[model samples]
Structure formats: C-alpha cells, structure tokens
Target: MPVYHSGFHSYVETEALNGALPKEQNSPQHPNLGLFAEQVNNSAFTAPRSENFKAWQYRIRPSVLHCSEPELITQHLIRDIHHKDSVLTPPTQMRWNAREITEEKVDVISSLVTMVYNSVAAVHLYAANSSMDKSYFYSADGDWLYVLEEGALRFKTEMGIIEASVGEIVVIPRGIRYQIELLEDVARGYICESQQAFYLPERGPIGANGLAEERHFLAPDASFENKEGDFSLYAKFQGQLWKMKIPYSPLDVVAWHGNLYPYKYNLKLFSPVNAVLKDHSDPSIFTVLSAPSLSKGTANIDFVIFPPRWVVAEGTFRPPYYHRNIMSEFMGLIQGQYDAKEEGFLKGCSSLHNPMSAHGPDMDVYTKASNEELKPVRYKDTLAFMFESKEPWQVTNFALNSVLRQKDYLTCWQSLETSFKEVVVEK
Candidate 1:
C-alpha cells in the first residue's frame, strides 16, 4: 500500500530525498541536491490568494527535455464536446447498461467512449483489461474525475502514486503526466472531463462539518522512478490525440511543494447530509465538489454522490420526488442498487435527464415508499454518483447508436395512473 497525506487542496511539502527541497524562496539559482527547479501554475497569477493554485517541483530533469516532434494519432472513441460526430436531440430521459470489458488487450486510453458532453464537461465510460506499459498520458483540455466502478487501478503521476478501487474517486489535474496501471484483470469506470477546476462545495447552514470532510481527501507522498528506455507520451489537445517519443520516464520528481496535485477520496467516507424530519432536502446537499460558473450559485459542473445513509423523514415519499430542473444530470451506479428505481437501474448502469426533463422514482419505488411503514431505515451497500451541469448535454453518435441503450426507458413511468378523487363537504 502506498502512503498518503490527508487534506483537500492543502499545501504539501514532501521529498523523496533529504535536503531535496530548497530552504527558502520558491526557485533558487541552484536547487538542493543539484535538482532542476520548475514551477507549475494552475491558476492565473492575478487570481485571488484563496483561489491561487501552483506547485514547485524539484526534479532530476526539467520537463522541457520531454518535448519532441509530435505525431497525430487516430482515436475515434475519445471525443470532445465540440466534436462534429455528436448529435443533439429533444429533451428526453435516457439510460444505458454497463459497457462490457474488451476481450482484446486494451488500456484506459483506448477504452474511453464519450457518452454525452457540453461546453462545460464531457462524460465518458471506459472498460479495459491491460495496463499502460512504457507510456504516459496527459490532457491539455481539462481535469479528469475518475469514478471507479469495477476494479482497482494504480495511478503513477508526476507527483506520486495513488491506488484506488471501487467506491473511490480520483481527480488528476490537467497537464499532469500520469500512467494508469490495472491492479486487477479488468477495470470499468466513468470519467468526467471538466473545463473548469473542481472545488469543495460551500457548507452554508450545515455549519463547519458534514459532506466530504477535507481531511479525508488524500494526496500521495513524494516518490520517483529513474529509468531510461523507449517510451511514448500521449496528450489530448485541441480535441485530438498527439504522441511524442521520449527516452525516459516522466515520473522523476524528487521533491514537490504545492497545492496543485492529483488526489483521491473514498465515497464511503462521505458524510451525507439529508432531511431528518418531514421532507427530502434538495440533492445539492449530496454534492461532493462543484466547478462554479460566472453565475453565482450555478455550477459549470457538479460531482454529487448518493452513498449509504439513514432515511428518517416522515409523512413524505422516501425516494426522490418527481420534478424538473434547469441543470442536466448524468448519473452512474458504482455498486448495488439506487433507491429511486426498484429495478432496471443496476450496478454500473448509467442514466441521463436533460434540463427540464422530469425524472423521479419509478412506479414500483413510488408505490412501495408510499404504502410501506415509515420506520427509520438504513440504506446499505449502495453507491451512485451524478455529473450535473448547467448546460444541457448532447449525446454522442456512438452512444445513441449503442445496443446497450434502453429504448423503452420512457415506459418506466407510463404505468403511473391518476389517483385523485374529489370530495364534497356539507356547508
């Protein structure tokens, strides 16, 4: 197991070698141990002090040495929000079964399939069997949020290494070189690439605690590997794949001190907040992270999770209520069953509800919650998450034509019949 330091966006100063970091000042004329000093800025220099993100890395070789003549590569499955192959359809509910793992050797990069996207974010699904070998990848477009559903994965990043399994999530900052290695025979998951950076949601009246505590988010300690061989570095830039040959491993940072690095959080550790007395609170209470837009409360993208929690609301329908909203939602199950649907929605399944497209508990779930006793029930063994955006999502051509799509998804609510009856009272 790899060691990790806890705290979200907290400044971390770690070194694999003693005296590897400079004593004072960020960049010295000569860094300690003869290491090269480089600074990576995630935000503008004029950004607010509280929002500024940057890191100082002391490495064996400067990153400029990794540059080479790039060659264009063809990757039809991976797409951006502006891809011409995407399709826009009328507002409708959609659902899809989990993608099957490939039988042939495939890595995380080759298995990525874009499902839906907008100007704010792109949602993708991946199923792969082989680990990345002598190759690394980075994205110049957006930060990656990985929601692991099936197997374990080891991410070797420029900062350090992080191992994550099902019921966990990992976020890699944009422009960070990393390689994904399968810890199991097969791996399946969902990824949300957001143009904006992710930040913890405000707590408001919930006080200073509850809902994804900052101390639970873990970042890896400093580690490095010095090896020379024929290797390739792939980059996702301008909606296309580019490759360059390199002679050595990119994970050569001996020391780093900064707030901009990859991190991981376990879903089971999320402290969920919900209604305890009479009604269901808005789903915003479940949000783990949000990328804010120019508009005050609206987010470019919100990552929310529905984990195991207690249900104690009285005189109210326990499952989610039927309604419509301005934000679009793309949801996936990481494990077990979601409470909103008694059937059909299974582990690893995905569903989408565009803006103003009404979605709620299915017929069976509604009937059961309405008639069953309202005792204090504890939901267990379930994990589901959603990637919500203010902008509506457009389905990709490949997702629309996939056989796993549920064509009869609308029929799940067709059986809902009117139960209203008028009564007269004597005046």
Candidate 2:
C-alpha cells in the first residue's frame, strides 16, 4: 500500500534528549516533535500576545510554498523530533460541567486533548440536536485555539451567536466559556486544540512563496454587535463545576485584527507538496497547519492530512493498508467515501482507534486492492483526516457506550477467507 509514513522520528526518541541538553529547548520552532516544550513555555500567557481579550480569525488559505525548497523547515522539524522528554512540574487542571444528559448522555470530550502535533487534528462533527452544551473550559496554563474544519456551526457564547462554516476559525481566548450548535445537520472540523497553542505555521523557507500566507487567513470583519439578555455561563473552576448567569452575548464583534485570531485554511488552497519524481513522501508533506508542542523540547502533537488528490502507483496498493499504533488516532471523513474504504465511515461519521489498537481498512479492502486492476486512480471524492494525540485517549463513556458507535468495528477487520503471498523484492 502507498502508506506515507512520517520520515521524522517519533516523539519518544527526541524527548530523551530534553533533560540531557536543556539548552536548545527555548522556542516552539524546534524541528522535532517536542513533548516538554509546553512545560517550559507555561508562562507565555502572562505576556499576552494580544492585549485584553479580543477575537482573532483566519480563513481558507492554502500554502503557496510548493515551488520553493521545503527542506529548510522540514529539516528543522525533523531534527527537533529528537528532543528531550522532561515531565513538566504539572499542568493546571481545566474542566467543564459536562454531564450525561440523555439516558445515554454524551460524555463531553474535554480535558485538553493533543499537545499540538506536527499533524493537525481537526474534527467535523455531524451531530443532530447535539448542543456541545454550555461549558467553560480552558488551558489556564496555555493559550488554546479552535478552527472549524468544515460545515456550519454557531459558537454559543455568553453574549450570543458566533456563526462559522468551512474555511472559518474561532480563537476562543484562554479561560473562556463557549458552546456550539450544529445549525447544519452536522457541525464539523475542529483544529489546533492541545497543550501547544495553535499558531500560524512559520513560513521559513516559503518566505514570499505564500504558503499559508497571512492575507488568506481572513480575520472576522463583522462589527461588535451588542445584545442584552439573560444567559447562563458555566465555568470549569479548578477542575470542578460552577455556573453563573450573565445578561448578554460576548460574540458581538464589530471588527478586529490580530495574529491571535480564528481563521480557516481551505484544504484545496493548500499548495499540495507532491513528488516531482516517483516515490512516497511522508504525509507531513501535506501538512496544512502544524502546531509544535515542544518548546525547549519536542512536539506533543501533530495535525497532518491526507487530502483528496490523484493516486499514482503502478503496482503498489494505492490506498492505505491495515495497521495500528501506540498513539490514539481519531479519524473523520470530510466529504465522500475515501478511496481506501468506499463503504462505512460516511462523510460525517467518525472512528476512534486508540493506542496499540489495530486499524486501517477492513478485510474486504485488502481483498479488493490485492486483485483489483491497477489504474491511475484519483482520490477525488473525499478527505480522510486524523486527530493523532501523544496522550492516550480516554474513550468517553458516551463513545464507549454509544449505539450510534459500532462496537463491532472489529468485524471490518475479520481475517480474509484466503491469503496471498507477500511480495518480496531483492535489494
């Protein structure tokens, strides 16, 4: 199969060095996936990259750096992937009042997820009547950001409605209370949530090439429209629950501009990094936005993508083959069915494969790909994404117990009735 495994070393390798050297761990730009960087930069918020609290935004921008050399930034990230892993003093606890509402309550998925990965972890939730319930949560210890991956959503703030869809982003200041509404059948695509605050990926080599160029990340232009009314705001106070009543909508932004904004970068706008010559490159080559968790250390999380594009393989398995990992991978389909698995995982459907768990296409996919005639296939219909986290995931009780969830997803991987010989090649 044409598996685009990351060429970079895993975080585990680099973190070992953080404690030994400790000198080079001062910035977020370390190339390797740094895990302890957040611990070192915990005091960043005191500097307040922005004064007071104001909304920042970015929109459907694509990288324009393809023609230029990428090895510069790529090498930096790859080298940094081998930093030291020192445990932080301790992370401040951030919680929200997320309770099971229905007989089967949706376990509010809180408790900061990723540490900011080289890969972008984005979720486009397709929920019905599911209000991401009024909850207050924040990384008091670090700045956090959220971007709408796709579809429409209403950010339910204490003030009022902050609406967005594909190519839109919302930067909820740290220690903020926010909820969401799926105005559309499914609200989708969440990005840049983790210990490492999401920032615009540096365009070191791109310089003027325009990859994720600033102009494309359109900030919110609406004026601060004010509203007054009774509203209830819930806060995650010291890992406990607390509630208070407020009298207005906080999203009444008339106009604003700042780097600390929420914006979306359309995947299509991505100046896709493709191979000039034939050979598979790591999917990091497709990274739209990368947040480095490791400051003085290595990366905590990586948000990368396998966007829709042409598939070129003469005799290789064009789609992803089956595999598993130690990291938790939460995957979602963006539009149509993926080239690998034409069935299941509908556009709005999501699948969670925890650490060390086996995943990848089911048995049927293997059978089909092995014998199917080779054709220059273009993965034109869909976008298959992943939210890979360094921290092991705690399958929410809801996820663990939802009927909508397929407990027997294992059936997808049932062993094939027959087997084929492995293709061995001589060096």
Candidate 3:
C-alpha cells in the first residue's frame, strides 16, 4: 500500500486490512479482530494548543501483556557536564573528522555517545557496526530526532517500519517502542532528544510553499511483526537504561491509526529561500523542524540545514558573516563541504560552537569569497545541518578525548591578518 501524507495535526487512519478500524468512533466497546484499543497521547488531554498530538491503535495484544519487572542496566548514557572528568573546555570552535569504529560488533544503542545535555534537550553521537536483535529501545526521557550522516537504518516500531539514510531524518516520538537495524556494516549519525515537540516554523511572509513541505514528510503504512521469541524492552528513563524481559515480541500492532506516528523526511526536497538582492538570510530560513522553548523567538532545538543553493547576491559578503549567536550550534555534515569552511568539515564529521561563541567563515573561505567573482554560483554536492539550541551543551569526556578531534582546529583563522584601518570612512 502507498504511504499516506497527512498534516501533523490532522487525523490519519490506517489499518493492516479493511474493517480493522472501528467505524464512527475512535474507541469502540468491542474493537474489530479481537484487538484492544490503545491511545498514545503525546500531550496533555486538555492542552489548549491545537498542535497537541496523539494517536489510537488497535493491536493484537495490549501493551500490558509486555510489562514485567524492570531491572537496572549498566548503560550510563547521560553526560555529566560538572563531573570531575567532564570534557567541558573553554569556549572555542571544535571540529572532528569522521570517527572510526574502534571496537567490533557495536549496536545502535550501545554506540550512543551522549555529547551534551541541558534542561531542554540532549545531543548524541552514534556509530554502530551491528544491528540490534531481539532488543527494542525507547526513551521515557524525550522524543528523538535522528539525522543519518552515514549508513542506512531501518526502524521497526510499534506503528510501522521506517527507513532512513544519509541526508534524511527520522523522528521517533517519545515513549514509542522501536528498534533499529542497520542495513550497512557501520552506521554513524547524530541524534537529538528533547522534551518539546519539533514542529514546522511559521513561514510568515514567505508563505507555506517554500521550505520543507509537510506533504513530503513520509509516515509508514500499517505493518507489524508477529514473531514469538525471547525479547527485551529497554527503556531509558531518568538518564539510565533499564531492561524488562518479555516472552513475545512487543511490536504486535496489527492495526494502527494516528497522527503521532513516526515519520521521515528527505533533506534534498527542501526548497531553500535565499537572498535575491543583498546579504545572506538567517539560517532560521532553512529550518526544517523547530522545537520552541518557553522563551519566545528562541528555540529549544532548531534542526536547520545548509543545503546546496545558489549564491547570487551582488556587492555583499557571500559567505556567513562573523558574529556571535545567542544559540549553541552543533553542526554535522551529511555530505560534501560547508561554504563557511573550505576544509576539515567532511561527511560524518561534526563541529560545535557554544552559545555566544565567536565563529565564522574559515580564513581560506573568507579570502576566496572576498576575491572571487560575485555571480550566480550554484553550490552543489553539500548537505550540512545543525542542532541549534538555546542552552550550551556540556561536552562529554569521550568527545573531548576522541582521536577524531582536530588538535589544530583553533589555527584555521590564524592567517587572518589584522586589517584595522587607522583612517575611518570620512563623511
């Protein structure tokens, strides 16, 4: 069956087969096919906002059947910024080359490296060599946004199956049971888990035609697994991983219908709105998804992109201007190069500039853009993105001490000569 494209707030009803869903009512006194009705609420029942998301499902077995005594596991995924061995360093631009798999047979959950955490969200770097078998993981902490930098990952969730590759992102709502199986030998990517719901930013004057169209966002159709085996349901709650043993597979949703289901979007489909006359537009114009914080105008986490686009502005600085931002920026390149940095920023590589951190174009890019002809130039073969947050990220010890980190990252702008002019522009 073809996948449906419904707006985030609109109702989307789907079933594995016809008549599986109850007619005229969401929760029926007797569900069809001897199924049990379950509601997955992503927001409070009486939330005033119309964007409040929730879904209902008629499954083969109630989720209560999968419940058991949970035992604490030794997976310490939370990065303590104030810890004695924390990698919290002075504010400076940091970059790392694509990391290598140091160990063999690393699974997705185990490969997670919690880079930073704050009240709103947490940033994580993940690289896995093997697929998780008979193991499913979900977080009671927050919803997850997965940006695949390398490798293909197929996620089998209670709702359905969704596959994500490089240059694509898959969002798994909080508390949704899902397990990832890698299609490639090794998978590397970035993940952001936040307490807030990621939504499309208001188009305002730009209207709703440009940027990421909600119709292009693909949600999986009704699909399920009826496997009977020794399975485990792993939950990450309160910054710790807990495992609950179950006899049968917990992914037995025979039929489901909901707007809160997981979905994936391709970055290439983003219609970028760029400058036509003067200076470069703010990166917020390229934001695919944004999680708004309590503070108005500031985002908890804005998933913005630097997609391949044309540079056509005349008599203006073509590259990003040097400035300090109030938001913390965590950038990762999915493929090709970032315009601000001519080198070192490669696919699967990442860079970070904390809140109010001084950062801009590299010396080489700055010099080239200053002298290069100002014409309509199309920047091709590049897809770089950032998880910009309102709060600063507490760097993890592993990221601080990783061999992939560039030791000479601070020297990128050393060649920028001081061009201070003694005579100011006279009126």
* Most TM-score-accurate candidate: 1
Query: Over the stretch 49-110, how does candidate 2's per-residue lDDT look in tens digits?
Result: 42223322111111111222211111111001122123221111111111112433332233
lDDT of 3 by residue, 1-427 (tens): 3354545545677787788888778889999988889999899888765667888888888788765799988755555322224345668888888777756787888888776677688888888999999999998878899999889999988888888788889999989999899998889999999888889888999985899887888887777777877899988887777899888777878777767888888899999998998887888999999999889999999999999998799989988899899899999998888899988788888888997889998889998989988989999988899999998876777678778788899898888997887987889
How many clashes in candidate 2? 59
TM-score of predicted model 2? 0.60
Q: Could you tell me the lDDT of residue 170 within candidate 3?
A: 91
Q: Is candidate 1 or candidate 3 better by lDDT?
A: 1
Best-to-worst lDDT order: 1, 3, 2
**Considering TM-score, which of the candidate structures 2 and 3 is the better prediction for this target?**
3
User: Local error of candidate 3 at 411, Å?
Assistant: 0.8
Most lDDT-accurate candidate: 1
Candidate 3 lDDT at 203 equals 92
Query: How many angstroms is residue 42 displaced in model 2 relative to the true structure, after the best TM-score fit?
Result: 9.8
Candidates 1 and 2: which is better by TM-score?
Answer: 1
Question: What TM-score does candidate 1 reach?
Answer: 0.97
Residue 267 lDDT in candidate 2: 53
- lDDT per model vs. reference: 0.91, 0.42, 0.84
